[model samples]
Each structure stands twice: as C-alpha cells, then as structure tokens.
Target: MTSAIDIAALDPASRDAGAVAHYGDPVREQRLLEEKVGLVDRSHRTVIAVPGADRLTWLHSLTTQHLEKLQPGQGTELLILSPHGHIEHHAMVTEDGTTTWLDLEPGSQLLGHLERMRFFSQVEPADVTADWALLSLVGPGTDEALAALGVDRLDPPDALDVPGAKFAQGTQPPRPSTIYRVAAFGAGWVRRVENGADLLVPRADKDTIDVEKVGLWAYEAHRVAAKRPRHGFETDHRTLPAEAGFTAPAVHLEKGCYRGQETVARVHHLGRPPRKLVLLHLDGITTDELPVPGTPVTANDRTVGFVGTAVRHHELGQVALALVKNNVKDDTQLRVGESTAQMDS
Candidate 1:
C-alpha cells in the first residue's frame, strides 16, 4: 500500500486548501521552524499496526500510556479515553519487538475501537495508513537535518544538545528508537518533538528523504509554541487528560485499569480541569487573519473558551491554543473574533 505524501502536491508554492498550507514562506516557514531545519509533510496522519504476541500486553490493557513496561527503543503518548474521561483516541506510541506503532488523528475510532476490543486478545489492529508516511523533523537544525540525510541517531543522549532543550524539561523526551530502514525509506521513525523529530516513512519511500519542506503553517506554528495538545486541536466532547496537557506524556497517573481509569482517577484525585490549556497572546496585527479553529473564546462577553490552534508565531506574534474556562483568568482579557487575547505568561 502506498499513497501518502501529497503535501499540496509537493510544492508549487503549496497551499492546497486542505493541508500543506505554506511553502511560499509562512513567515519564512516560521523562520525555518525557529532557526534552521524544517521538513514537515505529515502525510495526513493515522497509522496503527499493533501486531500480536500480546502487543505490549494488549496495549497495556487498552490505552492511556504506561504500556506494560514499553521497552525496545521506547516512545510514548497514548489515550483513547471516553468511558467518561473524554478524549477518545490520541496516539504516538512506538514499539518494535513485534509491533505497536500507532501515529494517529485521521478520523479516529481507533481502528473501530481496535476491532471491538478483540475478545480473547492476542491483538491485531491493522490500519497501516496506506503503509505509513508522517514526516516533521523541525528546528534547531534537527540533528543537522538527520545528519544531512544519512538518517539514524534519533536523539536521546542529551536530547539534541540544547536548542529548545526538548521542550524545556517538563519531561517526556528520550524515547525514540526502533523502526530503522532509513534512506529512501521503507520503514523509519524518528518521532520526538517540541523542537524536532517525527518521520515514520515509507508511503512509497517518501520521495527518498531530501529535506527543507516545512508547512502546515510551520507545523501549526511549532504546535502552538509547544503547549502541544492536538486531537482535533485541544479536544472537545469534554477533553480531560488533565485538560489537554495530557498529564505528562499522555497520562499514566500511576497506571493500572485503563478505559479512562475511572475518569482518570476522578480527575486525578477529586477535581480541577474544566478546561485550561491557555497560551493565547494574540492581540493581533501579524497582518491580521489568524483565529480560526473553532474561534469563540470570549470572557467579558461570556463565552469563555474555544479557539484551538490559531498560529502566526514566528517569535510569538499572534499565537493561540486555547481551551479556557477553568476559571479563565490568567490575567483575563480574552475575546477572539476581533482578536485581543492574553494569558501567554
């Protein structure tokens, strides 16, 4: 199966209206995604796999991280809630001692709820999004652009020697290593982020890995400047994985009993999380436009929260990434339609 890299038909000043939103300089591809190195593509997204031998104890009994001690060149992030915890199916897992992969977001039902929970379970799961593609790389010259296309070296030891410091420490960095097969691609992976990494190749060998691409408006403006909470952008249907900050590496909270672990352990011990993802800034004038994904986010006029990705940030110019209403007041002043945000501090 092979059909994933169409990022606006690979440039002609891209802007395919449905994906590749930039190529002809999204603020110089967000300043080469913040100072050098950029790639991106993300061939739509959605992989899946799962391969048996009880694929990590049947996905650690079914979701929200801590995959039965996930070893083999680790990688994490998981979710699939909705027994009440809400966010139904987020992804980015990885494995290779038989398969686990995952990637995500492309109209998820997580492969029909992993085929209705496979009764006796030896797991199967499938959906290999037309044999995978993904892409991404990113900034700080992403390990010198994967060592100038020679590939391998997927970050870990000193996680890229300090340019964004793998998301400035709040954890979840080191964990990428298992897929291999690089050059001209038939199987690859990279996948780390907040500054760089995430390849996953082989949708017909992703045009043999060249480099310098960057778009989805500079990876949604560095994933809303790294507050990263995507799953239909910051969720809805009642979010909660501690309201989008997916509890460090996509929720584990001491794991054990999946499916939404009793509303993620009663909202991690009784309460707090009626929405609160923040990082707005947006007072406007990056040539005005921004504010799109579900917009709304008011405050004095009432609404309270909405906008999810927004962008324009080459050095935080028009930012966004909201969810608000967890008592909305990180210095208030919200709004959104006419612009005016705040809370980015």
Candidate 2:
C-alpha cells in the first residue's frame, strides 16, 4: 500500500499544481504539519541531477548564486534569467562533490539548457525525477524523526544542510533530509510560513516510510503566512529578485558575470523595482471568503496591483502576498474581490 500506485489508497484524491492537493481533511493535515512531525509527498516537484568535474564552474556561470565555493551538501537557490533581467527558471541547488542536485516546481526546462551549454565542458545533466521522491517533514519533530532514523548531529550555521549529517528514516537512508527553521515565520510576524524540513529519498524506498501526507491547502496557508515567495505563484518571466525581497538569499551580488547580473546589480545599487512584494492583511472582521490569486488590488478605486496567494492562517486570520507598485504604500487600503485589505509591515 506504500507504492506510488497505492498512495491513492490514502485518498490523495485532491490535486494541485500536478501534485497531491490533500488527503481529505486539510485543516487536520495542516495541524499535523505545523504542530507535529508531518510528511508531505513532493512528487510534484521535479528532481534534476547535474554531475561532472566541471559541474560547479559550469553552473556557476549560468545561475544567480555562487556555486564554485559550494561545499558538499550545502543547499542554495539559483535563478536563471533572461538577458534583460527577468526570472526564467528557478532551482533549489545543492552539491556533493560529484553531482549537483536540484529540486524545482514546474517549468523545468533547465536540463535542456544545461545540456546545450555543455559544449566543451565535462558536465552532464539528467532529470532524475522518476528515480527519487522528495518527502518533506514539517514541524518541530523533524529532529526526532531524523534521530529516529540514525542522524543525531545537525549542521551548524546552516541547519538546512542535507549532506553534512543528513540521513533517512527507512531501511537505508539515501539523499538525506535538510532540517532548518523558517526564521521568516516568527511568532508575531504578520507573515510566517512556519518551520519545516524536506527529505529526499529514493523512489523505491519512499513507500516504506510512515508520514502524514499534507495537502496543498495547508501548504498555501503556511507559505502565505510566512510571506515566502514561490516560483510561478509570486513570480514570472517579468520578475526581478529584488522585487520579491529574495536577493538576500538567492543572489550573490559580488559573484562574477551571469545572466541578468546587470539588472540585479543596478537595481541593488541604484534603482528599486517598479513593483514591490507586500503582505496583505485581508479584512477579517467579516465572514467573507478570503481573496484568491489573480484578483485585482485596487487603491482608491484605481487598479494598482494583483494578488498572488491568500490564506486563512490558523493564527493570522486572513493574509496574502501581493505585488503592488512601489507608490502604493502600506498605510493605504487595497480592495480584493468584494472585501478591503490593508498592507501589513
């Protein structure tokens, strides 16, 4: 009953963005993920492998992050951009001497581009999506779960290290889980995505583990509450890293030339993005439904921005992330659907 074919027995009848949407009870599932050691089946996110002697240097020249200095097991993010400085592809990158592993949402044409760019380089890129499954654990129980699986020590500074002391929970551990706290999701923060960790496991060994399957509903609420940005939801081809406040983690400005470096550098030094990412606190005084994505945000009856994702958090009532023109200050009121929302600092 643990096979991919049998996971449907768990009633993973719901689907979102090509993945498991939920297991029937979204609220309870969310509770498990937030308050307990919960498991999420991330079969939706594609897993990519780039291996070779020149993998580090080759990837370094193509992405926004600095990879040449990456030690084995250090996980970071990479943003591939269009020449004029728009987000083209996004990948969660990590390396282990021989291979650079990546996890990403849809729109993963990165393998093709990586392979095409391998003219004389000794790099090899492969999409190992079918070979592995990403099983993520959410909540404070991550440490205990890892320890239960034989990993007693955690990485310092970067607690999110998956390789340093990373291990699994089944008969044999494979890619190891990266456990880290989500600092953005603080107690009083208007936006908090709650803390969680993800374990990358081999597809064959995946079904043997016992973990609660959380749905996208819970994930959406947590992510919106933390104000963390996602690829397709909060960004697109026209997005700049600075606009989403992701530059601090996703970009190494001091790194050498890469695609879209000019725009990133110029924006970091001189200009601000035309639009800025903001946290929207929906009008919770009423019983109206929360606003949904693609809804127009109006200020003083003037269209100014668009809503990204909104969620009714367990603690934060109704919250969402929006991209509004820089001129639209947080003090102003914005309209979403039939309800009015305010910007939260």
Candidate 3:
C-alpha cells in the first residue's frame, strides 16, 4: 500500500507558512477566497468505505442521513451523534453502489464508531484514507473547475457506475444530480481524486481552471461568513446537532435508531436546545488586537459563550462564530473581554 501524509502534518517551515498564515489572518484569506479560486490540501481528513450487500442499509441505521434513498455518485452531509445527542463527528458521505465512503476529519472518533458497528452487520467498513487524496476547491470558480474536469452534471442519486472523478456543483439544496456533496464554502466545491492519478486534466481554452494555492486563513474567513461550524471549534462532543445548526440536512430526524437519535429527537420536538450558534461582529477592534478562541463573550455583565473563530474581515472588520445561549437575541451587544461585539442574529 502507498503511504499517505496529512497536509497538517507538513512542517510549517518546509511548506509555505505564508499560505497557512494567510488562513489565520482573515482579511488576506477572504480576499483570496473571494476574488480567486484556490486549492487546499484536505488529506488530513479520513475516508472510510462501506462495501457489500448491506452497506447502505447498515449505514442508514447508523447515521443521520437517509442513506437508503441516496443514489450512486451522490453525497450528503452526516452527523454522528453520541447516545446523548452530542455531535461526535461530521462527515460527507458518498455512494457508488460498490462502496459508500464517509469522508470525515482525520483522527475523528466516527471511524472507530463505525468500525465497532460493523461487528453487528455483514457489511465491510474499511479505512480508505490512505488510498485516496482529498482536495477542497473553494470559491466562485469551483463550478467552472469541475466543468473543466469533464463532469457536466452531478450524478443522480439513482445513477450507477458514475465516474469516480466526477465533480459536483456548489453547495445548494436538491444539489445537481451530477454533483456529489453541496458544500458551505462560498460557491465552493470539493473534488476527490484517487491517489496515483493526475488530478489536473487537459482543458480547452474556455474550459481551463487555474488551481491557485489557498491558505487556511482564507478558508476560515469563508467559513465564518457562511456561519458554518468547525469540529473542534464551534462543535464538539458536548454540542448537539441542533445547537450547531446541523438539524437540517446534516441530521435526519426520521431516520432509524442511531447513537444519539433519542436525544436529538427529544431536543428537536419537546425541548429547546440549550444554545444556538450565532455570528459576532467585533467592534472597536484592530487586526493586531483580535480576540482569541475561547475568549468569553459577555452581555449585561453575564457570560454567554466563548469565541469559536475570530477573523479580521477585510470588508466587515472583525467577525466571529459563537455558540451563545438561546436567550441571546439577535443584535444583542456582547463583550469579549474588554472589546465590544454585537451578535448577528
């Protein structure tokens, strides 16, 4: 087997630290993410494959998405919750008849959970992260890039034998049948290519999609603007899908029993979630004076939530994502330490 390396594992000194630094600095990252299309190595995430006759049915019973209705070459977002309904992991699931791949954060507990679940079924789940390389192609030019790759439409849910090298359109509902997964990045698209193959394909004059290098800072800015939560930041084992706004497409309330179904259903139907995700626009802040993650956000001299992500927006100044208590209303004024910020409802 070929050895695989995580992009995050690369030494900062050896790699382009400037690019990653661009991700940490919001303004620079957003400019690159918005004005041009860029590529980021996502090999740090793991890919697990489920194969055999019972793969779809088995997964359907274990995840939040309705896998039974999923068509080959189609993909959907999934949240694996704990028995208490807290998020364990978020995944992008894709099916190709012979195999269903769950692409999740590297070292995520979902892989072990799925592995253990396999003992009760005949389906085979194998960690295939080493066999594939994942790349996140974000920005406005994403669709055109996929078009340059020969995928004109998203593969329908019912379609079989769809090419593995297919591209899906931007993240939108009832996503194009040819696209695999609808992503949250601004008009973003994800492309998965098997290892050992040339990812860059030949294109005509009008079809050429230039792969610009993007840093993590830019990706972070895009994520904050879209109000999408990250695993370790806004989401964790303590957070339920509802709290993180994963209740919609990421969680299937009608799906059969899974690890955290009861709690998710209970919170959705009977009780209010303890907290809600909110966007924060920091006031009177300078790029050098940005608040760090975990900085307590306070309102009326009380604690609400901590900053999850803080980005110095090129256009909007400083913005952040926070999981504040539900009582916090939109336009609520909150303070991060001594800095003032407003909650964007």
Per TM-score, the best of the predicted structures is 2
lDDT of 2 by residue, 64-158 (tens): 87777676645667788889888878777656556777888854677887787899999778898888776666777766765665544344324
Better of 2 and 3 by TM-score: 2
Give the Å shift of residue 127 in candidate 1: 21
Q: In lDDT terms, how accurate is model 3?
A: 0.63
lDDT of 1: 0.70
RMSD of 3: 9.3
The stretch of ten residues in a row with the least summed lDDT in candidate 3 is 194-203
Q: What is the C-alpha RMSD of each candidate to the true structure, in Å?
A: 16.8, 9.6, 9.3
lDDT of 3 by residue, 89-128 (tens): 8887766657777777656666677777787687878776
* Candidate number of the best lDDT: 1
Cα deviation of 302 in candidate 2 (Å)? 2.1
The lDDT-based order of candidates, best leading, equals 1, 2, 3
Cα-lDDT of candidate 2: 0.67
User: TM-score for every candidate vs. truth?
Assistant: 0.36, 0.81, 0.76
